[model samples]
Target: MSKSEDIVINWARRLQSLAQAGLTYSKEKFELERYQEIRDIAADMMAYKSDLPLAKVKDLFCNETGYQTPKIDTRAAVFQADKILLVQESDGRWALPGGWCEAELTVMENCIKEAKEEAGIDVTVEKVIALQDLQKHSSKIFPYGVLKVFFLCHKTGGHFQANSETIATDYFSLDNLPPLSVNKTCVEQIKLCFEAQADKNWQTRFE
Candidate 1:
């Protein structure tokens, strides 16, 4: 996406966040109506900019009523020797084993759960590799902001099983990776994981 497109998405997300907060706190009828209008405008902007249906954009971006915050995603970087673990998604592209962090689970727990569910592996969370702003790494425009936490995990046990999210799982060398699901995981992130793994005193990287 172009810089101009990125700016439009940023503006829409900001308007949506403001409107969501207003809807959550303001009780006055006229003020509520105004907030709804702001939300509609935001939804429209998102729909047009993203080439999504207006109703779908509203459902994804405007349905939630709260003080909007960046969503947390947990990814596990599990390596064996020189190879890093990656799961082939249903779409046939690979990504690290992870997904949206559940509100009920701690970040580590969410990372563990995603590793088990997506790649069918048991892992011990070693340390955080990075805490990244998704927009900085991906060109994909989302309705809201996302903070992706990559945990360097060590595989303990377990074998791959049939799962809905991913079709297969395997370890791939850093220099020989398959096509990636960029929205979920990117080449730069994989490289950082390898760098962190090699350095015993690696500092946690953050955006």
Candidate 2:
């Protein structure tokens, strides 16, 4: 992001934090009104930059009630025939079969569950390929930060199955890949997984 855009996002995050703290603790009408105004301004800033409507942004922001936290995303790069498994998403773009991690599961379990749920296949997670902060490494931007963990998984069993979240599952060669769901999975990250899978001496990558 440019310096100006970074400034805007920083201000938005700061204002959101203050508003949350104020709304959580203050009961006085005057204080609540002022905090609400801060939040409204923050929403406007975000909406203006994103080209989204103000109320839409406000609704997206107002639903939270505590300190903002990074969302956790997990993905698996399951290799077969020197190709990687991916599922077609609802939007018609393909991504590694993964999504938000469930709080009830360990990160490893989450990776396995995502593979099963989104790809309809069983996988044994072999090793961590990378743990990255999405905003830092990815060109794609979002309203909130995300911590993405990419795992190298071995297909243990089960055929390609399509669930509500995905339509079809297929393996693609790196040289001949389809359009990616950039927010969840990207070509660069998938390449890293391939590197780790091909070379046992590869080290874990992080940012």
Candidate 3:
């Protein structure tokens, strides 16, 4: 990552850590409110420093009452017989099976759950394919902040089942994946997943 990207990520991470700590230790509602105020202040400071608009900064800081940690986005690339599983997104575009990671679950567990929830398929997570920092990529969909983790998964059970988040699921050869939801997943990244699976090496990439 470049120096600017590193700086932004570090500041964002620190803000999240502070929010998590506050949520964990504060006993009184007033104290928790104070911590949230602090978190907002920190996020505002980052926005000012990074030149992000004020509204965007506020959105980044907003979270559930007791859940203040930075959110993780998890995705799984399920490959079978030289074809990769892809889901048709709500926006009428095709992408991988994944979504925002819940705080209650591990990264791998979240990956599996997303596959089932979005594509209606059971999958066994094999290894991490790559990790990408969204801020560095200038994404409008995630204008606030996000960190995405992509995992290489293998089909374990069940057939394709589309959920509310997706319209349909299908497998495509590497040469034929439709236009992806870049904010969620990218074709080049999917290619990396394929390479990692073929090499049997759990490689990780960062932006």
Candidate 4:
């Protein structure tokens, strides 16, 4: 996106966050109405800029009622020798086996669950590889902020089976990576995981 578009999106996100907080904590009826208006305005701004309709944008961006916080996503980086496991998404591109963290599960548990669900692999957590701010690394724009957690996992068992989210699974080296699902997994993030895997003393990277 262009600089102007980025500015608008950033402002919309901030406005929606403020409005959400207001709606959650404010007791005055007039103040609640004002917050609701602010949220509608945020949705309008996004709708004007994007192809989505006003109602769609509102549902996607303004329906949450809480103090706004970044959504958490978990990624499992399972390696076999020099190759890393990657699942072919239904979109016909590859990504690390992972998804949105469940509210009831710990991050590590989410990692294990995602691996089993997406790639049909059983894995045990080895160490955290990185914690990434999605906005910093991804080009795709989200209605809310996102925090992506990467875990270096050791495969215990299970083999790939066709699933709803993924069509196939395979291992690839850095020298030969397939077209990646950039929104979910990027080259730099994969490189960080490889670096963590090679060094036993690797510290968990953040930001």
Cα-based RMSD of candidate 3: 4.6
User: Candidate 2 residues 92-178, lDDT tens each?
Assistant: 999998888888988899999989888888899889999999877665435566899999999999876667899988999999999
Best by TM-score: 1
For model 1, name the residue pairs that clash: none
Clashing residue pairs found in predicted model 4: none
Per-residue CA lDDT of model 4 for 1-207, tens digit only, reads 789998998999999999999999999999999999999999988888777788888788987888999999999999999999999987899999999999999999999999999999899999999999998997776777899999999999998899899999999999999999999999999999999999999999986
Model 4 misplacement above 4 A: none
Candidate 1 total steric clashes: 0
lDDT of each: 0.93, 0.84, 0.75, 0.93
- lDDT of residue 12 for candidate 3: 62
Per-residue lDDT value at 35 in model 1: 93
**What is the Å distance of residue 176 in model 2 from its true position?**
0.9
* lDDT of candidate 1 over 43-156, digit per residue (tens): 999998997899888888887867898889999999998999999988899999999999899999999999999999899999999999988887777887889999999989
The reply for model 1, stretches above 4 Å from the true place, is: none
- RMSD (Å) per prediction: 1.0, 2.0, 4.6, 1.2
